[model samples]
Target: MDEVLARQAFDTALDEHRPEFGTFFLARLLGLKISYPDETCVIEFPVRDFLFNPQGSLHGGVIATVMDISMGHLLRHAYGGAGATLEMKLQYLSALKTGSATCIAKFLRRGRSIAFLESRLNDANGNLSAVATSTWKCSPSADPTDGKRVP
Candidate 1:
């Protein structure tokens, strides 16, 4: 992939395709910060008290959200289209607590109508706490302005 093209795609994803993302309730809840100009999309969030479970560990749902966003954003930025999750599977290997967490997402393959993606969440200590794999159904036709995300 060309650097210029990747940068342009990243800008489009952040600025043009889903401008409403800034106001998305979940986004604000997680305080997601995005960084991607390459094949992988990286999302980070500071673990807040409200996100903790009774065990004082990060909730699985929150971790899953990060994984989903990471892969979804990767699909959008890499292919210039939005994708819907058809199926998802997650595996939790450890509990995450303290500091921050980051999710690294990448596409394994993209076919005509389906895409396979995976993500890994690393705790503040850089230990892998969870992993997720998903299949997204890509649209056959996309809006010229917003790509494949259907409203």
Candidate 2:
């Protein structure tokens, strides 16, 4: 592992940490760059050695987290509120060992009290590495004072 790079990542996350939107700590730690285009949410991050598993590939948990973030952020961007993930299912198709990965999310369905979303993770070369679908319990909005979901 590149200790200097890892330390720099940690410092950046600590410095840029925020309680709202895309500036959450984990997102910062992973150096996630989030964007919304039309009706979809996209997140891109580097595949670093510090994020790797013993097998020298990005960890499955990290992949799942990125997918989850994409879907959750999509809900927040489309609607006027954030949502709690009630459940999520993921499938890993390819191993990512280098370059960057991008996750794109879109809503499958949206309702007053429930939402369904899907996210696809692709490697730098545009290979589909993983996919995730999730269900969320909707919230009315976020409390600006504390960044908590308001119902």
TM-score of predicted structure 2:
0.91
> Candidate 1 clash total?
0
Whose TM-score is greatest here?
A: 2
Q: TM-scores of the models, in the given order?
A: 0.77, 0.91
Backbone clash total for model 2 is 0
Tens digits of lDDT, candidate 1, 14-108:
55444453335566556678888567888888876567788888888888888988888887776567779999999999998778988999877
Model 1, position 97, has a per-residue lDDT of 71
Candidate 2 lDDT over residue span 1-151, tens digit each? 9899999999999999999989989999999999999789999999999999999999999999999999989888876787899999999999999999999998777776778889999999999999899999878764222433333
In order, candidate lDDTs are 0.76, 0.89
Please give the lDDT score at residue 94 for candidate 2: 96
